[model samples]
Target: MKVLVLGGDGYCGWPTSLHLSDAGHEVVIVDNCVRRQIDHELATQSLTPITDMKQRVKAWQEVSGQTIAVEFGDLLDWEFISDVVRRHQPDAIVHFAEQRAAPYSMIDRRHAVYTQHNNVVGNLNVLFAIQEFVPECHLVKLGTMGEYGQPNIDIEEGYIEIEHNGRKDVLPYPKQPGSWYHLSKVHDSHNIAFACRIWGMRATDLNQGVVYGTVTPQTERDPRLINRFDYEEVFGTVLNRFCIQAAIGHPLTVYGKGGQIRGFLDIRDTVRCIELAVENPAEFGEFRVFNQFTEEFSVNQLAEMVVEAAGKLGFEARIDNIPNPRVEKEEHYYNAKRTKLLDLGLQPHYLGDSLLDSLLNIALEYRDRIDPDVVMPSVDWREGRAKQRVHKAPAQPSASL
Candidate 1:
């Protein structure tokens, strides 16, 4: 299969690109390198040193003997995306090109607007590009579990069958997105459903959970091919952040009562889920939704797990309860259905097993790079003031072209 991985230089996108390429699919990466730029703007860097695109793909080719083509462009530009679609005519497109941080989106008005425009408009362009060129191409879009918010019911895959007013209808799950970034994803989901209904397009919306782990089979091949491990307030995920804190002997900062619960999966499972979605394409005129996660854990549970994992390595880790920066329920029912991926042959990797080797040890390995200042809650959900200084990210070096 010829696959085009948009935002293929990003944390999840980079590893997914390599996984597909290694599985013998012809992969072409399309990215503007904005993620790297965002790190520059936040005065933060990946805890693990990541190489540039040239070095990354070059190392992958040498290690796996697979060629993954890369193109420098933005998805918001219709002409650019349309031309690429027409030229490549890929069998599938794994769309991962968008601003993905919730806190960053909630920072200020400008950031909010940028997140929505970049994500919503860019997704629209991808839909139009597919409609124009490859109507048969399967679109594997990355949606977020955050889009569901904390609904007071068991969240179905993407829709629910409800009997309201003596009539039964299956509808897209009600979205209560907590941040602008998640709202953009909800908007994208609606747009894709509309497109599938009207244009006979096929798509699989993977409402993926928070991903953890930094190592995959492809990434372990070389140091330069390593993936990003971000542990800052804006981009760092909860479990990853806890691991970093434990490694640095800092208390795991738990927002509010730390009862907030969400789904999580290892980086290895993420790549496999992508493969499962691609291998079994959604039917034409179908917009399939899969709750792509292996396990669920509360914020407090994750902190405890990290503490125990740290103890095994001769480090004492503690938890600190802080005021919740975001407006959300600290405690709520969060039983979400995630059987689709498992049915598709996904062997789950529990957080307990990977806690030490995959996360804490990696943090320990890079202890020198861990910055304590950016570890705590910085963004305020009530106030729209930007937490981190916003700067124009410098352009990627021309060698990537």
Candidate 2:
């Protein structure tokens, strides 16, 4: 299949592009390098170094001898995006191109607006680009689990049947986004669904959970091919951050009661899910939504898991309870339905100690690069900078603020 991958430089996008290219597909990736710019803005580098775009393509070519095309342009621009669709006429387009960080979205008013404008406008541009050219092509968008928040109901994939009084109707699931970034995702879903219904477009909204791990089977084979791993407070996911913390002998920063439960997918499974979505395209005028997660655990549970994983490798690790920076339920009930992907033959690479160990071993290689100050939560979700309150723990150095 011919494939076009947007946001190909992103955390998940880079690996997905390689995976598809390796699987005998003609793949073309597009990125604006916002991620690199963000790293520049924050002065935080990825925990695991990634090859520059040119070098990555060169390495992939050497290994597979298959050319993965790349076009560096702002997909948010209608002309640039539509021209690609017309030129490539790809069978499928994977949309992992959005403002993905929750905390980064909440950093300030300017950051919040950037999240809203960039996410929504870029998504709208993609929809229009598809409608204009390659209307038969499939669009697999990477939505987030945070769009549902911690609702007190079994979170369906993307729709729910609510029977209030005698009226029974099935509707898109209620959106209770917790942060500005999540809100943008909700808006994207609305716009995508509308375009799918009105203009007859194929779209799949994969409500993905927090992804973890740095090394996949393909990545483990070549150090140069290791997927992007960011451990700073801004770009890092919870488990990735924990791995860095444990490797550097820093106490795991547990916010509030550390009971915030969320679904999780291994980096390998994330790519697998994307492959399945692309292989089985959604029908025109049908917006398919799948909860793309295989496991569920709380923040504390993940911290404990990381600690144990690192301990097996002879690393001393500990957790430090700290005040939660984000305005969210530290403790909540979270039961989400995620059978759609499994029904599509998504055999999950569940988070095992072996996998966690592999992820940590990669982190251990860059232990010297682990900035102790960058591991803790910095971008609090609240309106003000409430996360910077200095409180020492046991007369010792506190976790990063």
Candidate 3:
């Protein structure tokens, strides 16, 4: 199958591109390299040194003998996306190109507007290009679990069957998106579903959870092919941040009650899930949704796991109960259904002590590169309030376990 991975230079996109190529699919990656520019704007870089697109593609070819074609352009540009789609005429286009940080979206009014504009416009352009160029192309859009935002009721996959006044109807799941970034995703879902209904386009919206860990089978082939590991407050997931804190002897910063439960999956499983979605596409005129996560964990539970894992490595990690910056439920009912991917032959890589240990080891190796400044919460969810910045203290020696 010919596949095009948008945002192919990103943390997840890079490895997924290589994985797809390695699996004998003709792969083409389209990216604007805006993520690298964001790293520059934020003054923070990935914990793992990432290669440029040419270098990354070259490394993958050297390691796996599979070539991945690359195209550089902004997804919002209709001409660029349409040209790529027309040229490639791919069977599937995996969309991961977006400004994906919740905190970044909440940083300021300017950022919020930018996040919404960039993400929403980019997605709309992709849909238009697909419609214009390749009507049969399957769009595997990367939606977020955050779109469903901790509703009290058990979350269904994409849609819910509700009966009201002797009438039964199925509708897309109710969205309670927390941040502008997530709101953009919710908008994308509506647009995609509408397109499918009206234009007979096919799409799969993978409502993915918080992804952790770094290396994948294809990325592990070469040092240059390594995926990005972000441990900063804005971009990092809780588990990844915890592991990095443990590595550098910083206290595991738990926000508020630290009982915010969320679904999670390893990086390896993320790529596998994408593969499953690519292989089994949605029927024409159908917009399928899959909850793409293996398991669930709260912020406190993740901090505890990191502490225990660090203990085995002779680090007595401590937990700090910091005030929650985001206006979200610290504790909430979160029962999300995620059986679709599993049924589609997804063998999950569950979170374990060994996995945490391995991540900690990577952090330790890159410990010197960590900026210490980027490790804590800086963006406040509250509007019109001053941004609170926490600086990472010097790493203390591990106490005797």
Candidate 4:
């Protein structure tokens, strides 16, 4: 399959692009380097030293001997996306280009609008590009499980069966998005569903969980092929944050009671899930949704796992229950159905099995790069910036390293 990967330079996008290319698909990466720019804006870098885009592609080609074409342009540019679609006529297009951090989105009003404009408009352009040039091309969009928030009941993949007034109908599941970033995803999902219904477009919205790990088969081939491992307050997931703290002997700052639960998966499984979705394209006029996660754990559970994982490497890490900056349900029941990809032969990488090799060891290797200041929560859900930044455990001295 000829595959077009939007946002192919990002954390998930870069690895997925390589995986597709290694799987014998002709892959083209479309990105504007906005993620790198954001790193600069935030005065933070990935825990792993990632090479530039050109060097990354060069190293991958040298390692895998597979050529992946790259185009530098924003998705908001209709001409660029439309031309790419017309030129490649790819069998599938994996959409991963968006501002993905919830904390980043909740930073302020400007950031909020930017997140929506970038994510929603970019997705709309992709839909239109497909509609105009390659109607048969499957759009595999990266949606978030956060779009559903934490409902009292079980979360379906994307839609739910409802019987109202003695009539049975399946409707798009009700969204209670917690942040502006998630709201953007919700908007994109609705837009994709609309396009499919109105124009017979095919799309798969993969509502992915919190992806952990910094390595994949393709990324492990070369150092330059290493993917981004964000451990900052804004972009870092809970698992990444905890592992980084453990690496530097910083206390694992668990926000609130640490009862917040969400689904998670390894970086390897994330790429495989993409391939599975691409191989099994959704039908025309059908917008399929797959809850793409292998395991579920609360924030406290994740911290505990990280502590144990770090202990195996001779690191002692303690948990610090901090005030929850984000206005979310600290404790909620979350059981989301995720059988679609499993039925499609998704062999999941469980957290318990791969934590040491996938995350903790990487954190220890890059212990020198761990910025202690950025490990704490800075963005408040209600007021954007918190009244006071909390840093209970300062990073251990570099001399100790």
Candidate 5:
């Protein structure tokens, strides 16, 4: 199968591209290196350096003997995107292009606007281009678990069947995203669902969660193939932040009472989920939504787990109760049914201490790369705040796109 992997230079995208290509499917990865550019602008680099896009493709070719093509350009450009669809005529298109950091989305007006335009327009263009070029091609889009933000009810996969009075209706799952980034993803889902109905296209929106860990069998420690690891507040995820903090001997800053809970996944599982979606193509005119996650954990539970894991390393993990930067629920009910992916044969990789230890070993290599100043609560989601995070993240992953 021929596949096009968008945002292929990202943390998940790169590994995913390699995973698919290694499976003997012809793959082409398209990325503008916008994340690297944004990180440079923000003066915050990944904990480890990533090679240039061209070099990465070359390395993968040498390593796997796979000729995964490379393209460097923005997906927001309609013509450029359309031309890729016209040229590649791929069997499937994996759309991972978007601004994905919640804090970065809330950083300032500029970042917020970029997140809106880049995510919405990118997904829309992909829909339009695919509709015009390869109507039969399946579009595997990355939506976010944050879209169903701590709802009072149990979240179902994609759609919900409502029995109001005596009437019954099945519709897209309700969304209440906390940040602009997640909101943009919700908008992307809406646009694609609308387009799929109108254009008779195939699209799968994987509502994935905050992903952690960074190793896959395809890679060992090639800096060129090293996944983009963001440790700063702007792009660092909660678990990743906690793990890096412990590695650097910094106190894990738990905002509020630390009872906030959400679904989480390993980066390896993220790649597998994408592959599962690609292998099981959604039918034409179908807006299939799958809740993608291995398991759920509260913020405090994750913090405690990290602290305990640090103790194994002969390190004293301390906690600092910092005031919440973002205005979100300190605690809420989060039970999402994710049997679809499992039905499609998705093998999940749960978070264990061994996994945490493996991640810690990686973080230790770049311990000096961490800027302790950037780990604190620097951004607030509310309007008009003095402590809003200043850095802007490019965009990221089945995700807040």
Candidate 6:
């Protein structure tokens, strides 16, 4: 199968591109290299040194004897995306090209607007391009579990059968996005679903959870092919952040009470899940949704896991409960259904002491590169809320599709 991986320079996208190419698929990666630019803007870089795009492709070829094509441009440019789609006419398009940091999105009004414009507009272009150039192309969009935002009721896959009155109808799962970044994803979900219904396009919206780890089978082939490991407060996931903190003797910064439970998956499983979605294409005129995560953990639970793992390595890691930067439920019911991916033969790499050890070892290798300032939270969710108690703002409220 011919596959096009958008945002191929990103943490997940880079590895996924290599994985698919290694599996004998003809792969082409389209990216604007905006992630690297973002690193510059934040004054933070990937914990693992990353190769330039040409070097990365060259390294992959050297390691695996497989060639993956590359296209450099923003997805927001309709002509560029349309040209790529028309030329490649790929069997599947793995869409991961977006501004994906929730904290970054909430930093200021400019960042918030850019997040929406880049993510939402880029997604729209992809859908329309697919609709016009290759209606049969299967779009595997990267949605987020953050779209659900700790719903009180058990979170369904993508839609739920509700009996509100005397009638029964299945509706798109309610989206209570926690930040502007997540809200943009929610918008993409709605737009893609509508496109599928009206234009007979096929798509799979993988409502993915917080992805951890730094290496995959393909990335492990060469140092240059290594995926990005971000431990900064704005871009890093909780588990990865904890591992870095443990490595540097920094306290595991658990926000608020650290009872904020969320789903997580290894980097390996993320690539596998994308493969599964590609091989098992959605039906024409169908917009399928899969909850893509292996396990669930709270912020404190993750910190404790890191602490225990660090103890085995003779490192004293402690947890520090900091005032929450984001307005969210410190404790909430988070029963999200994730059986679809497993049913699709996803053998998950569950978080264990060994896995934690591997992550810590990686962080320790680059301990000198760890900047103490970037790891600490800088963006407050609300103005003046960081120092004083103010009226709590609602979690970015949910919108009905």
10-124: candidate 4 lDDT, tens digit per residue: 9999999999999999999999998887776677899999999999999988988899899999998898889988998989999999999998888766677778888999999
Compare candidates 2 and 3 on lDDT and give the better one.
3
lDDT of 6 by residue, 30-121 (tens): 99898887777777889999999999999999988889999999897899999999999999999999999998787766677778888898
Angstrom error at residue 182, model 3: 0.4
For each candidate, the alpha-carbon lDDT, in order, equals 0.90, 0.85, 0.89, 0.89, 0.85, 0.90
TM-score of each: 0.97, 0.94, 0.96, 0.95, 0.95, 0.95
Q: CA lDDT of 150 in candidate 2?
A: 94
For each candidate in turn, give its C-alpha RMSD to the true structure in angstroms. Answer: 3.1, 5.6, 6.5, 5.9, 3.1, 4.7
Which segments of candidate 5 are over 4 A away from where they belong? 384-401
lDDT of 1 by residue, 1-401 (tens): 99999999998999999999989899999999999888877888999999999999999989888888998998877889999999999999999999999988887777777888889999999999999999999999999999999999999999999999999999899999999899999999999999999999999999999999889999998999999999999899988899899888888999999999999999999999999999999999999999999999999998888888787777799999988999999999999999999999999888774455568889989989988878887778898866455443222222221
Candidate 2: residue pairs that collide = none
Q: Model 4, 9: alpha-carbon shift in Å?
A: 0.3
Model 5 per-residue lDDT tens digits across residues 179-279? 98899998999999998899889899999988998888876645577777888887888888888998888888888989898899999889899999999
- What is the Cα root-mean-square deviation between model 5 and the actual structure? 3.1
Q: Give the TM-score of candidate 1.
A: 0.97
Highest TM-score model number = 1
Least accurate 10 contiguous residues by lDDT in model 6: 389-398
Q: How many residue pairs clash in model 1?
A: 0
Alpha-carbon runs more than 4 Å astray in model 2? 384-401
lDDT of 5: 0.85
| Candidate 1: Cα lDDT at 172 | 90
Candidate 2: deviation at residue 183, Å? 0.4
Pitting candidate 1 against candidate 2, the one with the higher TM-score is 1
